[model samples]
Target: MKPLVVVATLCALFTLSQQAPSKDKCMCELTNSEKAFPYDKLGNLEGNAVKCNSDVTSQKARKLQSLMMGLERRLPELAKDIAVLDSENDEQMYAAISLQLINNELWEIQRLMDELNSTTLSYQRLSASATQQLKGMRGKMGELEAYDSMQVVKRQQDNRRLTRDLQECRTGHQHIVQPTRRPRGACPHGKFDNVTGPRVNTAGEYPGSYKYGAWGRDPRPAAGTESWYWRVMLISSNKYGHYVRLYTSLSSLIVGVSTPGNILISPSNPTTNTIQGPNAVMYDGALYYNCYNQDSVCRFNTSTKTVTTVKLPAGTRYNSKSNFCILDECYLYTDLDLATDESGVWVIYTTAQDFGNLVLAKVEDTEPPQLGQPRRTSVYKSSVSNTFMVCGVLYATRYIDRSTEEIFYSFDTSTGEENFNVGVFLHKVSPNIISLNYSPVDQMLHAYCDSIMVSYKVLFS
Candidate 1:
């Protein structure tokens, strides 16, 4: 019924036919013993050697017959079971084969045992060769495992070293990154009311703390009893301009000049006949200021009280809208629409913005001398809308630390200097001020705190 069974049956029929004695046996020729000896190489023997070979074949054939008989009985039952597995499902096909394969393997083991008995000496050689080959294979397998383990260890160490080096390099770079240093020093506070260096103190008595503002520039010597050393000035909150009031020693010496009252207030609007204030600088007895809502710088003669206007460019940040201050030869002031960290300082007379930029040009001369843009400098946290110069250094009131107010220190018109920082706070007392201004007569520094101003006289060796 099955192809394997049909083939096996046909092979058995052929084997039986070979064993049968044929009637044509008279036509066959018999070979000698010597010829039969060489027949061993041909795998076929008919004489003495054939007898020996036949004995081995007979024994093998007997064992094979027994094994074939056992397989024949078991294979049929296995086939019936396999048929049941196939009927169950395709997935059970492998299970059926596995179950039947044990019988086939048993049959093969029996056949191998028979062959081994027939060729006992050759079986020994095969076993010895197989054992040697197994030993060689085991040695190669051990070497591979050892090499793999060493490679793993080396890779781990290399990774750790690389990680450590990377971390060290990162730390080193952070340490050396950007270089910054804290600025150190003090501000120079000059002696008030003493006349040794600049102001003449012929009044003999020092005046206490009082509010005195500037009106234009009062550059007059002490004379009559009513004459004052400084003038009181005011910037009107109602209008965008400045005004001046004279505070002579004569007023204080005769009637005792009243402070908070001695200063003048800006006149009410629509008073065109009265003078409006601008930033003023006194040079050779001439006071210069800007008129109300005007771009031209106006000059006032102190001796004759004559007024004249000079046409000038409008300020950048101040379009008749901002306050202004004066340095020696330049007008130092801010502009309109000022930037927080980058406010503009417009120097009108000498034609240069001192703080943030340094644009220097002559106001009257037609020949422009290197008229270029100012260099950039960052401002402190607090806004520095005003500044004053003492000695050669400039002091601007701006924020240094975010928590407190500070005065920034710097010297303009210097060469190759980059250090600028918060110099002093109004609350602190010190032995040294950065740029101290002393009175020409009695030298002392006046430190003001609210209403009480303290005078310190530094006797420097």
Candidate 2:
């Protein structure tokens, strides 16, 4: 009766999607997915990782409270199913799923605590609330561990937890994170190697004011704009933006010495096709991003100031249903992550049919935008913090700490090979990186981390 009451409460939070109980073997008896958790593929964030002092603004304290409240709100999503997390004995095959959800929630709680430590204020009340919630959930993590008989369930949740901790043992901030891994693919551009740079750029004009956004070079720059760099910051609740900031060069953008150029996507309605999530990149002469409040990608041309869009395939998750998360926290509305490579424009997303795994599509360079056949992968989107393309290889990163992000997985589109052995660590100048991108022409990665524009260099041989 308790379990039923709890499930009903959670179900009330979402539009009930009632499904008849499986009379056959439970969904738990399903095949052990090769993509199961504790992802053996990914390694930990270890090395002589650089440590930096956190320079977070006080305003972020309020943001932290809001994010924690959101985390509590999302808890119901984990308990909406019929199974109870603590049912003593029942058809509770969903225990493992519930456990994994708990693992993620705990990880996020710990991550938020780390964030609280970095902020200027000691919002003791806020910290206590988060601490109390964390206590309430940690026991569930232990129960999942104690129920080792359910190896399949425990492993799935453990793997997801392990995947998030991909950076737990490391220390750093969000700034410039560059990976220097030799691509396991045909290097049409150059032989890829380890990326390195003077990674720290202080918070942008609005330090900690806007926490989500992206910045990078336009890989396929038009005639006169080869030296330009671009940025798109999600100015509303870290979910939406209507403008793209411009810098004359990487130097100007980094030095904070020049007035950045600007392009408003729309003068009247900021979100007509404006940026929706932080995972956007500037390519050629246009800005590519998730469209406002939709499951689509928007391309805003810099010169014409017009917009072009391509609807993502059906079953795609938008409006934050499928967002990016690391061990610490989840970003909102990052469903359609746009990236660029030596090849062309691309979008990394997830689909319901793919079971929330990653699906990559090439945004074909054409008059009206075209999306290529989506190449699906078993790599779970929830496990990756950010992704980028280089020489047709898709690389995924994970959040490590206050000043670090780690590149832990790679998927080559050309070879259809997934490699999770790339253990590369990057120094972060902020607490979170909402957006990241790679520029082919300059061989650089532009990271929009906690409202600051940071730079890193990744060259191919």
Candidate 3:
């Protein structure tokens, strides 16, 4: 019986050990809170079958409870990590949006810069085109002014030629129609008594006759009574090319009578100091004349025998080469044509301020000769070859021929009337009359004609 009981206990123990593995597997499935708990750990607990029922189970429960407490403490840290990841994802999304916006702004700025550059280039092209147009207009305006000046010169020449022809035709017609026979010895000696045309007084109240005079010998004045003097400027073959010789008697020159007492004026250095123009006038015991190289008026005091000079205004074009009078206008160089009346000395000059028009000024005859304010006259646009003052009236001469000059214009200072139809002809015996001067005392016109001195006795009506 005892033997049979022993066999039953052994069999019961083997069966309990196999059955314990199933119980441990069931407890691990029921108590394991972690989803990733290892099955090998459960099998190891089953092999230790001595403590599988109480100690192993209690130990596993304590370990699981400790693990649960640890997991609870770590839960806040894990949640913080997840929130940080979400914040990083949101920051990355905002960064991508900001980068795209920046690229769009860069493209807009580049477009504006390109448009500004294009506008600047277009403005430069327009400025270049406008400058070229203005230059072309200025060139065309200069051409028109030159053409108008030429036309005025041509018209003046034609009018002078017509007047000369009419006068010659009338003189020839009178001689052919009515011939007057004169007896021998009817005319006085050294006097022209023959008359042509009607005996009409053509000089008209002036104390001078401008009829054709016969070519006679020069009337030699007596010595020590040479109130009327004539000065001639000639180029000498000596070292001084410019020399001025004062003649006491006009007839003495024609008779080849030269006196050592004649006054001779010359420059210390003729190379620099050159006398200009055939126009010279005597006033208040002084001889007023123009200088050639310098734009200056010179005064020679006859008593003192000293020279005084007055400089003209700056930019005054008073050169020998410049024409005194043009076709339609007289230049400032016309001031070389000096004149004197009962009032004072006068000068006709032009300035750039006056637009190249002639201006007349009266000199005060002071120590330095102060010039008054210039007066603008209507005689600027007239062909005045020479000018003279008679009874305060300025008469201008126009060239008719070598032997004739007509007083075709007059400016009356008293009335301010400028007449262009003054048709009084002055017949000269010698063709080359270089200088003409009228003396109020003698009522004679003193003319210097190419080394020959001549005088005409003026007949007044």
Candidate 4:
């Protein structure tokens, strides 16, 4: 029965992970329990991707990734699908569906196996694990052939929901379209041209102690604090913070105003609802940041003193799995960047499905808050130093030197066109820009660079 459970769950999750990525993936408290599902042996499937040979194996590994994306979605449906199949008096249909599930996967494996036999350089494909999976699959193939004569496919479809789902697992992996383009929205502030200045640069009240965090003005504020600015310093391991400091104006943020208004995430325990990573954004009197120790976003309303959350995709990389990096070292806990632009608020991060390429999700300004249609980008997350969205376009920057940063790439979510040479350079007051945020209302790009806060005048065309 243990083996029966494993086999049925695998096929079911393959069906579940495919139930439409954007529309269905907002686990939002309603589906939090599903996040605890364990992958068990299937966890090692991604390990094979790392062992891929650059020639033929690389192409096949990508194919496997596509199939796994479908698999990851249905994975949560594992238990229910298993119950559907396991309810039978006898689990005779197991071998048939296993063959259906493993067939397409075997085609890719068999191709690598052919390559292994032909080239001496492909010795890694001949490992014991690979050989065993192939051997077991071949045995299932022999069993599946007899089921064809028995009209098993037609019979299974007549009575159970699990049958069609198992069949989808066999065929659904091949035709997934590239989700690179996003529908263009209005960019009233105009297209980005250049950014000037380290206009207001200074280490705040904490001085050089806090090296990584985010500070910026809320493009849409509550009432009369249009000139007000906010700062969130990642005081714990450059990754977590328990509070956000508020300044009445830009001068106060630059001069380190003492007794600045402070908002604590939790009154009883500072660690609860603490900010995670080097990036966060304050919008409409609420603070949005990566939820502490979880792959979800936490929204803390300053006025109500209440919190709400939105969970990212199951495959989203968090807790520093995909952070910004340069040639020297990577920034820790710099995953899940929150940005504000002329259009609205958005979150930028990467997922395993996109092969770790950057993914963007628009955050709606509702009471409980919800995630909008997600758009995928071709840019790799770790390849850039920081990112900010302006007028619905995402711009990525990389480290240059202590006095400069280069805006080298841009991805327009509206048309899915990628421009590799934006070539806009930003003058810096400090070496590293840990967090970069664009505020549409003021038309300013605020940067938190190595304990210093700086603002720039964004020049648009």
Give a tens-digit lDDT track for model 2, residues 98-142.
455466555655665566565425556545655565564565455
Tell me the tens digit of each residue's lDDT in model 3 across 138-175: 56545443545447756887898999999999997787
Worst 10 residues of 1 by lDDT: 336-345
Q: Candidate 3 vs. truth: CA RMSD?
A: 54.3
- Name the best candidate (by lDDT): 4
Name the top TM-score candidate: 4
Q: Which stretches of candidate 1 lie over 4 Å from their true place?
A: 1-227, 235-243, 250-286, 309-315, 320-382, 399-405, 414-418, 427-461
Question: What tens-digit string does per-residue lDDT give for candidate 1 at 140-173?
Answer: 5454445453377668878999999999999987
Which sequence of candidate numbers ranks them by lDDT, best first? 4, 2, 3, 1
Task: Give the Å shift of residue 323 in candidate 1.
Answer: 5.9
How many Å off is the CA of 383 in candidate 4? 0.7
- Stronger candidate by TM-score (1 vs 4): 4
Put the candidates in TM-score order, highest first: 4, 2, 3, 1
Query: Over all chains combined, what TM-score does candidate 3 have?
Result: 0.44
TM per model?
Answer: 0.33, 0.58, 0.44, 0.59
lDDT of each: 0.35, 0.71, 0.49, 0.74
- Model 3 alpha-carbon drift over 4 Å, by segment: 1-228, 236-243, 256-274, 324-335, 355-357, 380-382, 430-432, 457-461
lDDT of 4 by residue, 138-222 (tens): 6655554454555786677675877777778888876678676433534675556666454566786787888988898887787
Model 4 segments more than 4 A misplaced: 1-186, 258-260, 267-270
Clashes of 1: 35
Report the CA-based lDDT of candidate 4 relative to the real structure: 0.74
When superposed on Cα atoms, how far off is each prediction in RMSD?
A: 44.8, 26.1, 54.3, 28.6
